[model samples]
Target: MRVHIILAAVFWCGFVDSRKIRGISSSYKRFYRERKSFLCIDGSKILPFEQVNDDYCDCEDGSDEPGTSACPRGRFYCTNLGFRPHYIPSSRVNDGICDCCDASDEYNSHAHCQNTCWNLGQRERAYVEGQMRTLDEGLRLKQQLIEEGVLLWREKQAQLRELQQVAEDLQIKLEEHRRRKNEADRLKEQTLKALEAGDSGLIRQNSTVTSVFQLLDSNKDGSITVDELQARVALIHDEERVLSEDEAVALLGGGHQMELTKFRHTLWDILTKGDSVKIKDTLGAPDSLGGEDPHLKAADRAAKWEATNLKKVEEAYDTVNMEISDLQKKLTIDYGTDWEFLFLNNQCYKLKVYEYTYTLCPFNQVTQKNTAGTEVSLGHFFCIVCQTLTRRTVCVLGGCGP
Candidate 1:
């Protein structure tokens, strides 16, 4: 009788220490009571409490057979107290394979499962901590890049404004130079017309006309003889003939010889006015009196110089305008909400694959080069998509693309 009492006491102690329900988590233990009748978790039916985990399915929802594989939809819980808690399907229980880290799923099977949940949980926590640190560092660096990129964008805006001002200044200068060129051209035309109309007072006083007379007077006698005029190669009658004696005398006012005063009065008009008179080459060359008046030449040179200056100013203006256009286009781009991608504006990256090398210039173009150094344009920088700035979906046929 004393032995029976001791055994009964031990059983009571064991029952109190482990008020166990198989397969149920601690949170669900209140539902499974030791009452005479048991209710299904879905309120489908009531059964004898002894029917729970009895290796038979009664409840349509499989709530009465949580600990057994008798119900196909039943679930089994593993109370991995030292690590993490989770649930396993009822089918995985006692199938000769351990599905729970606590080895409880194979309790009726021959397979042995070790309780490795605590060690696995430690490794998982370490990995998660490392990933957290990496993420924190990455975010910090990203913020730093955003700050620098904003400054870069500001600098670009300033540069664009300065260029626009320069373009405006260049446009004003270009207009001024064009005006000067037009004025010089008009003055040149008027001077040539006045000289052609036999304005002899200017011709007589001119040093260039005196020089020509001296050149024609080979004997230096202050008079140009027909022999002297014939001796000089300055006169050409036509393409196939030299000047004749009669033509030379006629050029000197119907006389065999003429003084400088008469020669100037007659020969100057003939040389300047008529298409019948042809001067062959420059002053010191074989055709000595070849060109028009020196004053008119000087005016022509001044006009030409002004034109050249105008052209240079126009070119400068155009260059500045092109720069302004490019800057405006760049500013309109969506680098990022915070200009975080502004640093990659003119940057390039190269990648090699097989025998080809691909080059990517951000906000510019993409090119591919073969091993033989043949480069072909693959595409240009279209709009950014999917948060990657360099990736593009199309090509344009132009200076920046295929």
Candidate 2:
């Protein structure tokens, strides 16, 4: 009777807006039969249906409950026309999380969620664009530094090689001098022995010694005068040996001739042995040459130069790599799984407060420095809180700002 008529009206409720009609996909151009009859979504049952948006479950598969939270497995579709359509669980439909910009999911919520999806979309667009722009600029700068650092490292290495070669050349020169000294000593000893054995042909170990002495006697005198000897003596040793006039003449041993006998005694050791001791000193004494001037000073300077440049190049190379590593880590943290954020790597963000200046160098670290030359480390960029703080702050956007 009257109750049967109400029940019949419920089974015939057809699909309306978004819900599938009769819970099945069939061409129903015209409801030739009685239009009030309806089928369950799974075709397992039949019922007379009306407005299904009544916040009640009418099907086992929850197909009859689309907008309400009556069914846990029900899916709600959001017609986010300003952005894009999306779906969410029925349980989260009215959870107050603003999952949908259209606010369709919160239709039954006690807390009023406004339809601010259009404004939110605009803000998101602006933020994303700004982030990309800043990232691009920051990346460009970092790339420049990287390029400069690479070239610097290469140039340093080349200079080092050149210096090393100079040092090696100097080393070779010293070794040759040593060999000559040994030969001279052997010759002097042999000549001395021959004189004692009465070999007249070997009276002078070397005729060149006599010739040099004669040239040093600039006054055309057979002997070296005091003034003549002292002037030339400074050139013989690696360090200057300024002999007084009397001291110079005393080297002659009361001889009228600047003979080989006198010349062989004073300053002769270095003349024969080659002043290699002072040369070895310039290299910072890495070794004694396994035993241990010139040409000796030039070689010394070259060796020292090479050592200094080698250290410089090593430090630069290490620093560049560390900077690159820090930048890469920071980029990932700032923009989750997005490669565009890599542009922000190695970038610095700075803020100026009332009396202090704060700086955050992506991935490297955070630091605060006052105007009075005082600096303190806030934390490393890798730390979660430290990185988050840097992102959340916009006091004075530096290189990473768009």
Candidate 3:
């Protein structure tokens, strides 16, 4: 009877311990009452939470009672079987850590755990350091380029200053040249006026001789006819001479022509031989009678004056044109050979002319393929001398396509 009681007590204690290990309780029963749910472990479905912790896998995803350690191929609890317990990435759950090579990490009651997680951490650190080194090298090159750009800017500033100074000096020199040329022009005008005054007396005497000759040839026939002689003699005397036929014949002959020529010479010598004699006669004549002489002299003087002035004006215009042409040539050389001077905004503007020619060919597809697959050929050349483009082309016969 004593052995039976002891054996019954031991069996009851084992049953109570097993019930505790499986996590079976009145609350568990109440929670799963009348509910059709499954535990996910080892790809199987089981009825209640009592079966969830029965040291068996009963859920497909091991989602049932994740806090427990009853499911295989599910979450495991390690009590550090031989080393320190440590958490790892979910992918490393069953990867067999070096510290847990005995698979003790899958047991909830185990206490020995070890960790060897330094290799992955070291690899990440090394990669980050390499990236940082590359970034530092690139930053150093960028800084060097910035320094070079600053030095180039300073050099350009110095060149600009020198150019400005040279431009100012050229302006001063141009002004001085203009002033000297104006002074020379004034002196030339004064000299021309003096030379003109010295020839005035001789001009007056020549004018009187011209007038006398013009009066002798009043009909403007280039010769003295009988009518002109009659008119002259009538002005000096009221008597008229009637010419007989024989006398008229003798006058027409060359025998009496010498006498008439001598008479004309005598009159011209009396009038124009000496300036003093001409001036004396001019002063002695009545003011009303000689009024015509002064008017004629004034007209002659004006004509001579206009001729001299016209000559000077022409000379000045030629000088100005020559200087302008020289300046244009110099400007073309300084700027570029293709540079042209255009008048705009009341000033001369230098402009460059660029000329080129491109040829377009209209041909059929077959011909285009035969002609190196080219639709257009450009034969381009620039003439710096004349700044022009010359293009020539031969038309393809019957090759154009619609």
Candidate 4:
């Protein structure tokens, strides 16, 4: 028996033997119920079931002759199978229109529609699956980047916290050392005045800052450099516990050499004040957390530290904020128009033919990219299924399909 299908209807002509009809969908399966020697389309009218598709209308609703043009208002269902099905008016039955992929609508016509059903089905299935794979890959990458963004945010937060704490510690230590240095300088000045006034008894006691300076004047040049200072490096340790070469030079008035006055200044602090804290360049590195500016006066180091620290901290904070904004933008793009289309959000779909390349970017715009030169805008893209078939159904010829 030959089976002919039209839109949503099925009929047996019992004359021509050919391909089998694919199983009906759940929505149309209800029509097959309550079958007997005689059946009505609605089971309300009784007619021989054999009368179906006999080229004449029977049921008032025109459901009996579903596969033929027996009723003007009846509908035919095309079981497109692998693709989406469509409905056609029953009057179009055998009217030479290729309404169904299986060509059952023109089943009895001499120019019988060829069975392009399986070929079209296979092609459409492959296209849909390929599209799905592309979306899946994009979704995976988007998810991975989002996770990385979150990790980066946490790491930056921790780094900023650590930087803040280190800067604070440096500030406190720098202040304490500056104060101790001041106290030591005052004592040295007082002792110098007493010596100039001819305090011979105190001089003989050999406990003056001048005596420490004279001991350090190894070359008798009445000054010191890194080379001369190395000899009394141990004494330097005793005073400040440690001193960098740069700081040593800075204490001597911003030169490679320190004269007697400069030597006395630090020497008094070190020798008379054994418990005095040593000054370290805690603040001024190429990219230090915080520290004093060596070239400035000791009084200004505190202010400089605060200013420089604030600048660096603010810059770092702004960088973190910008990164957060970028991540948020990525997130917005990751889930475009709808969750299913997230991969397509901000994404461009292209189809290249002989003459031009067509592009569709969801929720953005459409364009035709000429293969030879310039591209032109076609229209705006939107959400219809999120916006299904916006404007019109896009189609292309040849063996290819979208």
Candidate 5:
């Protein structure tokens, strides 16, 4: 009977042990499912707690079973009342040092950890609030600046409208002035055309006389002897003179006789008579009228016209320059000083005025000035290739002789 009792007791104990083992296995599987680290050796999903304290790394990230420290690089968070939550590495999770201000890293059942997390949490909250307050103040200042910018924009818009009105008025005046100038130009052009026509007629007449004279003087000897020339002169003067062999050769053709006679009459008549005469009065002396110097009078009239046009052009240019100056001033006021303006007006002016002939000197002088310890006032050099001024001394060295 006793033996039977012992056997029964042993069986019961074995059954209980088996049940406990099964329960542990079930719990491990449930935790593995929740954490998704099950079957880690074969790359299957299971719970984190199942592999938490396993000697071998089971999960790829090793985030399982925070209670039993396993993975060295894992993180754990401790909830501390009245204190900011803190995270510690898995290696420190069970180090028994109680590093967390709240001492929450130690399990509630553990005896060694103490509580100070509430004070740390309050301090952290206060620090964050202070930062928020500073940010709020800065935001308010930015808003004020934005308002000022808006007001400035409104004023600029008003100024732009005024400027536009001024521009329009100036444009209207310019158009009127242009119209007057154009009319004046047209009148001047007509006068010039009339003068050109008169001059052209005289030139044509002169050309005809020249052609006739060239035909008569076929040998192109330039001049006739006094005796031979007298014969031709006498033909116009109505006197007698002797002709020579040279004269006979020169007067080979007689077709120019009538034209020459007509030319003589026109010249003498214009010089002697002062009144305008009909074109048919070719046999009479010219009328010398009024003692007027036509050449001088025409030149004076042309000068007067040019002066008037120049004045008008100057006025137009002045108006344009004024507008440009005003626009430049407005731009400078709206934006800032323009570096390009300084560069063009100052630097370029200096380069143009002083640099033209400085390039003819020796390179040694240039180098001396460049390296001079004192404030050396070195002149600029002219670059023949680029047609600009430069300070570089070595450029174009040993080139063509100056």
Candidate 6:
């Protein structure tokens, strides 16, 4: 009795599983009823169930003959069990060539088709798995780069802040130094005018002569010696070389030194009227003014020192300003939406064409060099645009050619 029951269950399962209509996928099996009449798939007509796969055209829309090529526009399904299910044109059915991998299309033909769907499916699965692994690795690397880029961006911002602070400090110092220099100059001018106006015949000379005398007489011994002239001025002779000691003495009225009165009568006139001497007071010399009023001498020295300090401060301020400008420009660049491409900033790539080598500097410019070493700029990086269909981005270069 148990053996009979098992036999009956196996038969029933087989019958139920084999109830699918010919050339119809399992999803459409409900429409292919086992009853007497068959309704066209488009509901355009009703036909007898025997005409479903008959070798005769029945319905105008070819819906009643999907399993055969009876209708020119009909479609035949290939239930490729081990791979993908598909449909082929009805004209290709039983045409000698095996259009379906399972040989279902050539059911009544002599042509043979092999079941290669399983092998094709295996290869497709492996390809998809490889692509997934590659995508995972690419995403991981992208995340790492983005992190690194963020750190780099923060570092740059820190540098910018530090530079901005330095520039601000330098500006303040520059202003202070400028004020000190101006005050010193005003005091020195007032003192020199008072000394020149006094009846002390020691400096009964013009303001220009008096100023020249004070600069040259760094030791303030009431006279300017050859050593003092050489130390105080870069006396260019003949517009090409330094003036010799003899030349200095000749200009100083045939003596090695000249008092203020003789200097006015000789060197001052020559300096102002002739090109025999060029006196550029390169003033950074030590002075001990024993013959002049201590206050006046102190004022002159203070003015010279302040002027030198102001120059140094100006130079430092300029340097800081330039650095700030450069940092601002770098910070304003567009790295990426998430700063992902920041790692490529200032990085360069190269490619060689037939007769030229092209260099691409990210966020900078593109240039090409020929075999002869002549380089031409292609363009500068302008913007980036994403192509929707391609799902990729392209950089747009501008300002030159392309």
Please state the error at residue 24 of candidate 6 in Å: 3.1
The lDDT values for all models are: 0.72, 0.53, 0.40, 0.55, 0.43, 0.73
Q: Write the per-residue lDDT of candidate 2 for residues 1-402, one digit (tens) a residue.
A: 999988777765532333433211123223212346556457665655553545677777666566677777777777765565667777776777777777777755686777777886788788889999999999897677666655544554565565555555655545554453444444445545665687755543344354344334444345666666554444323334465556555555554336556666753444435433111233233112112112223223333343444455555555555555544343234432223344455689999998899998765678999999799998665553433655643232222321
lDDT of 5: 0.43
For model 3, how does the per-residue alpha-carbon lDDT over 239-328 read when each residue is reduced to its tens digit? 234333344323334332223344345534533333211221222231221333432432333333334444554555555555555444
TM-score to true structure, per model: 0.64, 0.41, 0.24, 0.41, 0.37, 0.66
Ordered list by TM-score, greatest first: 6, 1, 4, 2, 5, 3
Model 5, position 172, has a per-residue lDDT of 72
Q: In TM-score terms, which candidate is top?
A: 6
Please identify which of the two predictions, 1 or 5, would achieve the higher TM-score against the true structure: 1
Clashing pairs in 1: none
Where in model 3 is the C-alpha error above 4 Å?
1-117, 189-402
**Worst lDDT 10-window in candidate 4:** 286-295
lDDT: worst 10-residue window of model 5:
334-343
- Tell me the spans in candidate 5 whose CA falls farther than 4 Å from its real position: 1-61, 107-114, 178-402
Off-target runs (Cα >4 Å) in candidate 2 are: 1-64, 83-89, 92-99, 106-114, 191-203, 207-402
Q: Cα RMSD (Å) per model?
A: 14.2, 15.2, 27.7, 15.2, 22.9, 11.4
Deviation in Å, model 6, residue 174 alpha carbon: 2.2
Lowest-sum lDDT 10-residue window in model 3: 361-370
